[model samples]
Target: MSPTVHEIRNAIRAATGRFEREFEASFTKEELQAICEALKITVDGAGRPSTTRMRQQIRAQVGIAESLETADDSTFRKAELQAIADGIEASSDQ
Candidate 1:
């Protein structure tokens, strides 16, 4: 079954909480605010988290600007390929 709007909203909230916790450890408030702006998310005037529009905006931005048209089959394979390529080129003249 497809997720309801409430479910999606809850998921976003949970993910945002995790992000904020992680960011708090490594970033300043200003940096985190900038990231929020980039994501187009913000709290509404009512004090409730209101990221519905921002989530759509961010998704659209990514969909429109993504350079990768194809999906990566696996993250590990992609990392392995990158490491191999970098190693070969780096060792060529070293």
Candidate 2:
């Protein structure tokens, strides 16, 4: 089965927390743009994308990627994905 919306939201929250910790201060517009490119996500114009948008997009991309990988691995179940998401959320809460 596919991941539930709750699982996806939890994953995104966890990812946002990690991004916050990693950046500490903030990421430059250039750096955010670079990340967008590396993630194969398109930004509309030359103008910088908001940090919030970048974070959301990155989290979604990551979540999708993880889901796809899990789908391919027979041993990985829906409950496993939830557990992983829960773990990430728990770690970030610290």
Candidate 3:
């Protein structure tokens, strides 16, 4: 199942810190793009955003510690990412 708007908000907040331990899942390409916007990180439309690009943007802007960062986009989870789009009413699809 997907997450609630509130949950996504919390997840977004958590992404700046200890993200991996916060959630377990992967955001879709669409959801990842939405997150970048929500976090005020502009994504160059060179192509569809990938996990690496988004993660780099998030890391660069948010400055999540590498020593503390985890391996995957499991930071906020796929559901939370979808909720970001839904909560903001930015996009219809995840």
Instruction: Tell me the tens digit of each residue's lDDT in model 3 across 1-94.
Output: 5555445544544453323334434555665676677678778777776777776665544445242244234454445455444444443222
Worst 10 residues of 1 by lDDT: 85-94
Stretches off by above 4 angstroms in model 2 are 1-25, 64-94
The Cα local distance difference test for each model comes to 0.33, 0.46, 0.52
The C-alpha local distance difference test score for the whole of candidate 2 amounts to 0.46
Candidates 2 and 3, the one with greater lDDT: 3
What does candidate 2's lDDT look like per residue over 21-55, in tens digits?
Answer: 33223344555455556556787656776665665
Better of 1 and 3 by TM-score: 3
* Backbone clash count for every predicted candidate, in the order shown: 0, 0, 0
TM-score of each: 0.27, 0.38, 0.43
Clash pairs for candidate 1: none
Ranking by lDDT: 3, 2, 1
Estimate, for each residue in 2-91, the C-alpha lDDT of model 1 and write its tens digit.
443333333333434423232213233343333345455453355433343332333333343242223232212223322322322212
Best of the candidates, TM-score: 3
